[model samples]
Target: MKLLPMFALLIAGFIPLTSAYVDELSNERVFFNKMLEVLPGNWQGKYADGTYENPTSDWQPIEVNYQITSGDTAIIENYVDGNESAIMTTVYHLDNNDIRATHFCGAQNHPRMAGRVFDRSSNTLSLNFVDVSNLQTPADYHSRGIDLKIIDHDNVHVTFSGLENGEDSTRVFALTRSQK
Candidate 1:
């Protein structure tokens, strides 16, 4: 009779724990799938910064187009007015509870950038780039990083920062989604 009470107690405790575990697993899967879905699609936008001699100069911003493969590989092709195309490949995956992406392009100016997705919701996604190589600006001897925040799936705000001499200089880029 005593064994029956002990078994009941064990089963009751186990049920709640098991239920909580299952719920967590389900939530994780849902979040993962949502993250994957948001990345694999066409993204058309512009990039701009006020670092130039004239902040209001009418230089045409870049046109970004991305093709994401089923294998989580992304091909990013960018076009700037009167300039050749710039191509990059980005691989994205989940690493230790964080979504990470490695971006590689053979540009002499910018070699590679590594980033992580910090926050994600149904309508917004934010990414922060940690590893950046800036090979173009030698005089500045600066390292650059990027941060992107998506709003309403159509508007995106991007920031680029240069880390040099223990100081940081930031430039903001605001873009609207181009409708095809």
Candidate 2:
């Protein structure tokens, strides 16, 4: 029948679109799995503002513990700030074929970010601000971005960017995976 051919054509046209979507999902799964492989551990480092090239005396101790929980569906990062005795947390998980994160900051706001760029060859994942929750004011401080790089199995460099006091601020931490 004529309708049979028409329906076949319609289905055929949608096949490519579905395949492309599936390919994207597969890539995201691969990226997230790679992240799980490299990110679960206790990391110790020093933190500094802007550039971490300041004198050792000026740098503060930074300790981070990453755990895979919720049936391995989420990665949680507990960030300890030695200078302020503050502990912040961020949770990373996949949301419908996209990697997303929610950072709980000391500013009393949570900023949600999504993975904007993933360079598999370099082992880098960059997340940019999407929105914020519990923001009392438009100018209230909240995290803006995150840049995470795995230098090696035991070394990592992370930078967090935000707006504070109406100025762009950054915290850089150079971390080494703790052996003990």
Q: TM-scores across all candidates?
A: 0.50, 0.77
Question: What is candidate 1's lDDT per residue for 12-56, written digit by digit as tens?
Answer: 999999997665545444544554554334355444445433344
Candidate 2 C-alpha lDDT tens digits along 48-121: 88855643336787888899998777999888765634388989898867888999988889999987776667
Top lDDT hit: 2
Clashes of 2: 0
Question: Lowest-lDDT window of 10 residues in candidate 1?
Answer: 73-82
lDDT of each: 0.49, 0.82
lDDT of 1 at 73: 34
- Counting clashing residue pairs in each candidate, in order, gives 0, 0
Candidate 1's TM-score: 0.50
For each candidate, C-alpha RMSD in Å? 7.7, 4.9
lDDT of 2 at 22: 74
